[model samples]
Target chain A: MTLPAHGLPAGTLRRVRIVGTGLLGASIGMALTRQGIDVELSDSSPTAQALARDLGAGRLAEDGDDAAAPELVVVAVPPDVTARVIADQLHAYPTATVTDIASVKGRILDQVRALVEPRTLDRYIGSHPMAGRERSGAIAARADLFAGRPWVICTDEDTPAKDLQHVVDLARLVGGTPVHLDADRHDAAVARISHAPQVMSSLMAARLKDAPMDAVALAGQGLRDVTRIAASDPALWAQILDANAVEVRNVLTELREDLDTVIGALDGRVDALGVLASAIGAGNEGQARIPGKHGTAPTVYSTVTVLVGDKPGELGRLFTEMGEAGINLEDLQLEHANGQQFGLAEVSVLPAARGPLIEELRARGWTVPE
Target chain B: MTLPAHGLPAGTLRRVRIVGTGLLGASIGMALTRQGIDVELSDSSPTAQALARDLGAGRLAEDGDDAAAPELVVVAVPPDVTARVIADQLHAYPTATVTDIASVKGRILDQVRALVEPRTLDRYIGSHPMAGRERSGAIAARADLFAGRPWVICTDEDTPAKDLQHVVDLARLVGGTPVHLDADRHDAAVARISHAPQVMSSLMAARLKDAPMDAVALAGQGLRDVTRIAASDPALWAQILDANAVEVRNVLTELREDLDTVIGALDGRVDALGVLASAIGAGNEGQARIPGKHGTAPTVYSTVTVLVGDKPGELGRLFTEMGEAGINLEDLQLEHANGQQFGLAEVSVLPAARGPLIEELRARGWTVPE
Candidate 1:
């Protein structure tokens, strides 16, 4: 996981202290450590700090180890405790600038300001890296977790330019793209994209819990895709939703109206076809709003479905052959049939490459279904 | 696509008539035709019928053709037209055993029963092949589309064993496993797993349609997975949802209640964490109800994440090496850092194989991050 050094000095910061040793904190520590920056880690749970240390995130911090404070401190605690932790970190290292990576920013910023003195508030900022896996803890931490991810920094009137620069530099050091935003806007955006989706996905999957086994067995890739996020960390998500509940509720209310309209059409009170088509069309437009190079979906790309054994390395080989063919993949989706031997790899490529890619793969002893 | 066939007796019975030339109809025609059975295609749109015919789905039905009757008539039309088409097919081919592949079974069965004579009703059966793509029309048809998917048969009291066997034989010919259930059960099952999911996905995506670009850009894999099904055929889904509105509404109402609970927790009115945790836990349980090779999930399978380029053949190489390692992949997921040069292949294998697989992959010059 080592890479050539960058962000050699965290801008006048001789050392960095991370107050939490969870995935986000440990990952920040590792990323900074990789750049030869000195990092100290501590967690309320001794085992956790020890584990993060064992994972090479950083060394443990001790009282009076260095009366001269580190240049910066990062508080990566749970959302509910973020403000308190941020205030503590600001107080613990009086000279050090501090930032907390909390998904919900508005409340945390307000709470931290109320808890800390005006002087300490100037040295603190709130930021959130739009990154995480479904798993939790230091065990899930990686140096490259935040690479290429968006890290939103919330600015306050009391925040100093020096502290903001340090935070931005840290984000860059971790290979994150930093975006400047206010706390309210950041919270609102995340509520729309993150918290609401979690609730929706969970609500859908919840229906399946009480369903018959046969009905559940009737599930397909569509159901799998729609319910995948329903598997997120319950403890963490609960905290996040509570933090951003108001904005999330606004989104949820609108969704309810759409649901009610579709239900009415389905109930045969209106022209079902028109109502249903408009609902699905709205979804289509919404999905398209997700900007990417995915190209024109459900079209524009020719799908080359290669059947590989569900055993290990088959996908690797298939993709390797695709590389040899010199075809760019617009997207790749893998679908498995429970009782079937083959896993279906639906690779979407440019329509122009369809003939050549399929021909090349088939010639390379792969099964390319037309 | 040719098969040395056992459904040859189906060919001997006269012909197989597909009354719609869309994906399902064309696919059924192709599967039957490939099994060396005679197939006749007809659709309301001449262009659609012609396209299906050109795609080798089947030959077009002539004016004087099937005077005696085809052995089987599949009414693969929209849910609204299903009953009428089934009745028309039954009357047109009095001696033929008729089936409709509409998603909903109860209403269609009731409608057809009320429209047709007792004997004609006896000759018809309601069936739904639990398969579809996000796309529609003849262009998306495939002979193996139904392979490894469940085909549900809605049985009636008057359904003769011989007619049922004919339908079962058709299912087998298309590589489907047939499950027999009454119309009510079939409707309820599809409502829970299929129709309700569509409504939920669409409802979520509908929110995104008016979202700010930056907010949408904050979208991640979870959002994508949850909204992927929202891109389905709205016209078709509207009809399907309308046909099964009652059951869909029941599920939606319960979901609304769960939403309210979570909203309350978010509003700081209740023990937010407890309510949120329970809601998420319910989702976890419901997702678990999905019968699959995925056991406990996020735990059962040891994940060996292999870093590979987002290019054509990198994935193929990873899978090939996986096969060479002699490890069976329990499940595989591919995640790419948006705008990154490479994607990560997360291969889940048996816990025992994890250590060896990682060592082997690393030895072969692939990065297997823990």
Candidate 2:
């Protein structure tokens, strides 16, 4: 029996089969199931499939052996196995549209193309939802993980519009905004934005490997923010970086040049200050190029830092007051003093809301510090 | 007239003078004046001093021209000018304990030691309150700037106990936890943790100077976090880097070796994966070494990522519910999806509260995603 559409047209995607029950796969299944669509789960590891099933991501494929063929098959295996799984699934589910959610797209697409016939290729598209956490495994999966995140849909020149549409629908069904990008452009984009930062963060944190505890103790928000993502699973990261090595290498080579110049300046070059200043100035421009916190467009929000008492509910009361004032807190951070009894909640709101939020908080007898 | 100690003894610090009216200077003056202590402000820039005075940081030194010698004198100037200012203030306020708030301690302390006689040296202590913002100037200053932040106080062998105590009192008066570190150790610690990250962030962002716009549009939270501090003022950073050059250079050199190894692996050595994996894994260990969010001690907080609706008071309501459940929200980040209606509020709380918090949230009909 066909079910109502999760997001795509009715009957077009009544059932989805996920070939791997890892973080991304189970997450996709959970999201689709939450939308009232049927999802089937399988994994090379039976234990993992049981875990994903227990997590309510989907039913085990074994439990649905006699069920009709899935309308869609998602190959969510690791990059090395992704092509093999896609080929196997494409043959196994002739009527299903196939897609894979791998971080690196171009190489995987190339591999799948070599393994499949042109007709089989027509039913396949590659998509990547740009969402992840430091943790991994089925236990860490979430239904709304892809919500409001960007999902890149890579299409071949000969890809049918309808097939592309199906992949885009899957992305949207999970609450992602699908952006059309060619495989090459997608790889290059991730290499610049994702891979390079991972390398730099890893390298930067590597210096702290044997650092004195006291030295590490002085870590502030700046250092913390820059190195937060350095805690990602290393083996997984190595594979992702390996797949996107060429593009990452290109960026790293250029970054090394800048590093060398900084070293030269530090070695007491006559024009060291000028070199150092320009390096830092370019950084200012680069950082400004990033989209604002909300990710829609560029914005410069003003922060209204308020005194937050250590007592329970003080923060809650402050947020409640802000909410009642019709102010939306775009972001907030709590900075408690090293050994102090109170802390500051630096609340970032829309620039226009800054004055009103602060004025209202103070009017309500709260200490709205700068 | 003696005033009740603003967390310090009364007559011991009846009046304070700040010799610079920049962000840190103005913030200190404002916090002191708010506690009912007499504060005097001065700056080479008359406009700055006037603005700081108008902002209630303190009265202009003119108002205190005939006042008794300040019981305490603070020198808050640029790194290059720190030694000169400290020497000038020490001679100007012989009865007052003289201290300078500079980021790099060893170099400035050496300069001061060379400039001052033995008695003058006994009155001088170098301090650094590990609190700063990307912005500068008196306008950006806040009275609570140092609250809950670590303040490093460096003392000389000949420094009298009372003089050291007064400097410690200054740190506490502004709501900071005073930690004593020799100038050498303090400089080395900041060089490894702070200066090196600044250089790395700037160098990484520098590579984006000529990058395609489309690539930059793919920037995510990871890239933004790694480069957030790159927006700092270049000229000021260059000066700071110059003062801590030797130690910073040492760390950079070690980091460069790691970079070379990473590049070698990316070039496809047979042992590439192991090398790359080790680098990334070392990062995992290093990142864990950092103290928790507030810098007080190491803490392992579990994050509960809740699906927050876009409605104005949704966050407030959620926080209020959390407060009612007796969960102290330690830290938080709100990530809004691009063009999406809902956001994720990743709330950090005590690990013990994770299960209860999630159970309560789900029972209250909120979606607490993994």
Q: Best by DockQ, which number?
A: 2
Task: Quote the positional error of residue A10 for candidate 1 in Å.
Answer: 8.0
Q: Give the alpha carbon lDDT tens digit for every residue of B139-247 in model 2.
A: 9999999887788999757779888877887888887778889999999999889999999998887766777786776677888889989999999999898898888
Residues A1-370, candidate 1, lDDT per residue (tens digit)? 3342465653555578898999999999888888777899989999999999988899998777766567789999998998988888888778788999988998888898799878778898889998888888998888878776778998867678788888888888887778888888888888878889999999899988878777777777888888888878888888888788789878888887777787677667888788888988888888877655332122355787777776556676777777877887777777765566665778888889989988888888886644
Q: What is the lDDT of candidate 2?
A: 0.85
Model 1: DockQ vs. true structure: 0.61
Runs of candidate 1 exceeding 4 Å displacement: A1-14, A293-302, A311-313, A362-369, B1-14, B66-68, B293-300
The per-prediction i-RMS, to one decimal, reads: 2.4, 1.6
Name the lDDT of candidate 1.
Answer: 0.81
Candidate 2's error at B237, in angstroms?
A: 1.0
